[model samples]
Target chain A: MFELILTLVLLVIGFVFGQIAEKRHFRSIIQREAETRDLLCFNERRIPQDMFSPHVTLVCGSVVVSVDFFKHFVATLRNLVGGRVSAYESLLERARREAVLRMKAQALAQGATSVWNVRVETSSIHQGQRQGIGAVEVMAYGTALVPR
Target chain B: MIVTNIEYIPGKKITQHLGMVSGNTVRAKHVGRDLMAGLKNIVGGELKGYTELLTESREEAVRRMVAQAEAIGANAVLNVRFSTSSVAAGAAELFAYGTAVVAE
Candidate 1:
């Protein structure tokens, strides 16, 4: 019985570490931010922005999470459905955010100011349900536009 | 990431760009989620760096893009493109560009 308990504890610890490392990896990829020159400007229009802003996006191919989202989710879900949701949410959100950020980074590299009509789309790699070690993806994309 | 209402509308003069457009700090939760996705790339996982930044930057970009397009009296945007660059170590940029045209 003691051995079993110990093994369980080790498994949790390992998972936690993996989570931490994964977090670091995401941070590094999206380490860059918006620059003044990289800002897309369209000064002529009148329509305002809505949906989610000052927002961040990441797309893979499935689900995605942002730092704020994952943290809040982990805390809230932990209080509700325990931490089992951690692995699923963690992977999904992470991929989503990374994919979105990469799109932005690519835009910036192209000497564009901003990307418009931003969105993240998700698609499953394998058909059928995403159960038991199945890998899925969520893609984040938007128009890289220049301000008028 | 495909955005809605960004194309030229028959009655509307130009496409409406909607997304996150702000000059504020990105939260930790969002960043945390992004990191997890980055790690997945190791095993031929999808890289999602573009999605996050695009989503965040699109709002601002669209806001400006629309404003400019409107100013130019453009009714539509076509063949858009995205671009980015390094501002600071932890900061980057995302931009969208397209031909602002006056489509009936």
Candidate 2:
């Protein structure tokens, strides 16, 4: 009975540590900061905002995916374990959603109401040093429009 | 290797397909300092890397696509388009496409 309890405790601790480690790694991978040159407007005492054209080229964002990643890692595991792959699904979906959000922000900053002719793409990337190979990337982009 | 943007330009042939390209790679870094800037963007801060990569890759891929166009007896490419895929972590594929055309 003691041995069984100890084993269970160890498993819980290990799982917790794994969650902590994975969270850090995932956050690092999902970099959601903006760039200066991509800027349209901001409040600052120094530089006059009018100097730079408020017209910003909006972008929804991009992603690199490996179907095998979902298949082998998440999907396969879910199939074998009979559980949901919510964590993995959220990563992929968030990337797409966040990208579009950024574009919307850019448009808003530039006084644009809507974007036009948006383009979204998914492409395969088979770059592994050896043996196992599979991955995919999705990129979303669109033009920002400003009224004259 | 084909571009949708080039379509707006007249006298260019639009290729519906992207040309075959290999080793067309793009690398971006979120250096510690860069991350600070990005975090700043959270509350009226500046985000980094996204635009630069977009502009850089677009130009590079377009250049490559243009070379392919020249090889195929085309004068200008129209309706240029851009795409990116991660072939590996730390390495991304940048593809540009446009219609290859000789002046009609």
Candidate 3:
């Protein structure tokens, strides 16, 4: 009975705090993305003949996001049903957008006008004793072209 | 040395291709970070410690890759790629690879 109560308490705490954090993070991401729209980004390797810049450097951004206890529980139930685990989807979406935003921030710091050949990689990292909780790491990288 | 993920650097010609070069590293954070991460798991937020770890490991991997390219007399590495995998319970491995090339 004690274990069950503790679990329920943890779930309630997770649900409340996770929702608040997610909402705040999404608001920030959307605002920053709009501000960063001028920084051109492309996954294509080719650059137009007139678009070449003299200085090139590699830039990267990475983020690690963990799932809340309540979402983790929901995902566990989802696994048993063999269907889409929506709880985790929002987690990954937030992570990817944050990673990209960080990458853009880095590029802007370097005085780069554009990023080319952008790539994103995501991995599931183990969190030691708490294997029940899911943590994902997302990394965004590209070459930033700085005009002379 | 010039490094870019694209297959070729714009406005430059590749004089030679020195095959493939790669570097890899496995890293684990201290117990304190793990404890903090566990606590952060409840509220569901960014793990800044893990992000720093990944950045450091990636820089190390890229440094080793650049060293390999230099040893092979390549002035640049093109088509660079990065990958990560959890090699252990608390350790992650970062790998970087690219084609070593001489460009003019």
Candidate 4:
């Protein structure tokens, strides 16, 4: 009974705190995405020679995020039904977006007008002691072309 | 060395191709980081420790790949790619590959 109560309490606390953090992260991502609108990013292998810049360099950004206890708990419950695990969906989405934003920021810092051949790679760094996932890592990389 | 994911550099010419070069590293999570990550699972956010580990592993892999390219007397590495795989429960392997080339 005591262990049950502790688990419940932790779940409630995790839910409250996790919700706040997720909302804050989403807000920041949206704001930054808007600010980086002008930094062109693409997956094309080639950039038009006419618009090409002689100075080219590599840029990369990485983010590692984990799911809160409550979400993980809910996800486990959903797994019993064997359907989509929406809890993890948002976690990965945020990580991917954040990684891209950071890459764009790096390119901008290097005075690059655009990034080409952008690639995003994701991996699970930690699997939870429990059945759920513990942490995920997203890495975004690209070649930046700095104008003369 | 010049490393780009693109097959061809914008203005530079590829004078010679030195074939494919690769570097890989397998890294395991330390006990302290595993403990911290366990705690973070409660009210989670970013996992800084894991991020650092990945960054370091990637840099190491890239460095080794560049070393191989240099050994081949290549000035550039083009079409670079990275791959990651789980080697163990708490460990992962990061592999980088690219074609070494001479750009003039």
Candidate 5:
């Protein structure tokens, strides 16, 4: 009985704090994305022919995020039904956006006007023995074109 | 060395193609970080330790790739790409590859 009560209390705490953190992260991502709008980023395998850049370098950004216990619990329940797990979707979205933002920031810092062949890779880390997911990592990388 | 994910570098000419070069590294999180990440999961936030680990692993892979390119006397690496996979329960491998070239 005590264990059950403790689990419920943790779930409530996770729900409340997790929601707040997710909201804050989303706001920050939106704001930064707007700020870096002018930096051209693409997945094309070729640099624009018209581009007059003489120097190119690699740039990357990475982020690791984990779902709260409440969402993890909910996702496990959803898994029983064997359908889409929406609870983890938002977690992935946040991590991807954040990683891209950081990569853009790096390019901008290096005086790069554009990034090409951008790619994002994701992986799951720190899975508990019994729990489903402990954390997810998103890595964004690209070549930055800086004009001479 | 000049490194770009694109097949061709604008305004530069490739004098020779040195073939493919690659670097890879596998890393695992420490127990302390694993514990910390577990707690962070309860609250739902960024896991700084894992982020740092991935970053370090990427840098190491890139460095090794560049070393290989230099060994072939290549001045640039083109069409660079990276990949990651879980090799173990608590470890991941980061791999980077590109075509080394001599350019001017």
Candidate 6:
């Protein structure tokens, strides 16, 4: 009975707090994305031929996002069903967007109007007996074009 | 040395292609950081500790890559790429690679 109560309590805490944090983070991401829309990003390997003036540099952004207890639990159950894990989908989406936003911020700070050849790398971090994802690291990098 | 992911640096010509160079490092966060991350996982948020670990590892990898480039008489490294993998239970491997070239 005690174990059940404790698990229930943890679930409640995880659900309530996790939802609040996700909402808040999403709001912040949306606002920052709008603010940084002026900086363009492209994955094309070739630099624009018409682009003149030649100041360029490299920029990168990285972030680590952890899953809440409730989401992890849900994902584990999802594994049994062999289908899409919605819990992890949102988590990855958030991490990827956050990483790109950070990269754009760096480029803008360097007086760059756009970034070219953007690349993203993701890796899962495990801790303590590989008990479900401890966290995920997402890194975005690119070459920023600056006009002098 | 100039490092960029693009094949060529803007306003510069590649006088020589020195070939590919790479650097890799495996790193793990301290116990304290792992503890904090565990706590944060309950509530779901950004893990600053892990982020710092990745940043540090990436810098080290890049530094090694640069040293290798310099040894090859290259002034720039272009088309640089980064990769990350979990090589052990607690350690993450950060790898960087690019072509070294002489630019003028």
Best by TM-score: 3
For candidate 4, lDDT tens digit of each residue in A1-148?
Answer: 9999999988987799888989999999999999999999999988996987658888888888988999989998998999899989999999999999989998999999999999999988645344534788899998999999
Kindly list the per-residue Cα lDDT of model 3 for residues A29-132, writing each as its tens digit.
99999999999999988877788875788899999999999999898898898989899989999999999999999999999999998999998898454453
Docking class of 2: incorrect
Name model 3 segments beyond 4 Å from true.
Answer: A127-133
For candidate 6, give the lDDT of residue B81: 95
User: Residue by residue across B24-69, what tens digits does model 1's lDDT show?
Assistant: 2221225554455444422323335534454555466655766666
Q: In model 2, which regions exceed 4 Å deviation? A: A1-60, A63-76, A79-84, A109-111, A123-137, B1-59, B62-78, B86-90, B100-104
Local accuracy of candidate 1 as per-residue lDDT tens digits, A41-85:
332222255322322221111223333323333444578756465
- Backbone Cα, N, C clashes tallied per candidate: 102, 37, 0, 0, 0, 0
Give each model a TM-score: 0.39, 0.44, 0.95, 0.93, 0.94, 0.95
Native contacts recovered, each model: 0.03, 0.07, 0.79, 0.66, 0.85, 0.76
Candidate 5 lDDT, tens digit per residue, A1-148? 9999989998998999999999999999999999999999998867766886888889999998988999989998998888888889999999999999999999999999999889998877744446534788898999898987
Candidate number achieving the greatest lDDT relative to the actual structure: 3
Against the true structure, what is model 2's DockQ?
Answer: 0.11
**Candidate scoring better on DockQ of 2 and 6:** 6
Q: Model 5, A134: alpha-carbon shift in Å?
A: 2.1
Cα RMSD to the true fold for all candidates: 13.9, 11.7, 1.6, 1.8, 1.7, 1.6
Candidate 5 clash figure, as a count: 0
Under CAPRI classification, how is model 4 graded? medium
lDDT of 4: 0.87
* Candidate achieving higher DockQ, 1 or 5: 5
Residue range with the least summed lDDT across 10 consecutive positions in model 3 chain B: B3-12
Candidate 1 residue spans exceeding 4 A from truth: A1-17, A33-84, A127-133, B1-5, B9-104
